[model samples]
Target: IGVGTCIMILSLLVEAYGGYLLTHPPFSVPYYYVLIVTEESLEMIGTSCVVGGILYAMRRVSKERLKFS
Candidate 1:
């Protein structure tokens, strides 16, 4: 549970950073192409991780339940 929560929080931070880069490109860079690509990739990866963690946690919980006959 703790690990999952930590992963989710880290994912959120990565997503936010990517968003910021997308919206505000560095001045030294003439083109924003790299920023766009990086942002998209980061967002996709972050979302995947978050979803995977949630599904894993859910499965773990469900599997732990005792069955009553």
Candidate 2:
């Protein structure tokens, strides 16, 4: 969960940088497009991690309850 949150924050920063670059780009147009792609990819990966973490926690809790029963 913490890892996912960090990634999400990082992606947000990347997106903000991209927005800033729109007016003051240091590189070519293609580079900005690439940055956009990277930002989107990061967001997807972060979401997956959060979901995976939730599933793992749920499984662990279920296993503990089963043992008690």
Candidate 3:
């Protein structure tokens, strides 16, 4: 969980950096590549989060038969 949180923070930072590069000057080749990769990473993060949420909901719903007393 801690590592996932760290990755989430880094992902947001990358997104912001990419946004800044897109709006500013000096749009070099390296920056363009960074922006592309970061964008892909952000998409993957979003997809994973949605999938995780769905799986969590399914797990909770399926656990109705469990008696943990």
Candidate 4:
């Protein structure tokens, strides 16, 4: 959770300073960069993270239950 929180904070900071959607004269982002090619790519990345986390948590919970049983 701590790691995920850190990562989310960093992403927000990057988006805030780097660029924003529906803005004029594209903001000149510096210091760091992320190669996001398209909108769908970003959606895919988020969806993959959520699905993976859910699956991982389910597996962990089932394993712990098995041990108790």
Ten contiguous residues with the weakest lDDT in model 1: 27-36
Q: What lDDT tens digits, residue by residue, belong to model 4 across residues 1-69?
A: 344444555555555544553255654343224423333344455566666788899999999889953
**TM-score of candidate 1 versus the correct structure, residues matched by position:** 0.55
- Ordered from best to worst lDDT, the candidate numbers read 2, 3, 1, 4
lDDT of 3 by residue, 1-69 (tens): 344455667777777887788788877878678777986786677667767777887888889767577
How does each model score on TM-score? 0.55, 0.87, 0.55, 0.46
Q: Candidate 3: what lDDT?
A: 0.73
- Residues 1-69, candidate 1: write the lDDT tens digits: 455455556656666655666677564353345555555565566667777878998888888895556
Task: Point out where model 2 deviates above 4 Å.
Answer: 25-27
Supply the global lDDT for candidate 1: 0.62
Off by over 4 Å in 4: 1-37
Best by lDDT: 2
Model 2 Cα lDDT, one tens digit per residue, 1-69: 889989999999999989888878476899889999999999999999999999999999999889953
lDDT of each: 0.62, 0.91, 0.73, 0.54
Clashes of each: 0, 0, 0, 0
- In candidate 3, stretches whose alpha carbon ends up further than 4 angstroms from where it belongs are 1-26, 65-69
Error of model 3, residue 33, in angstroms: 0.3
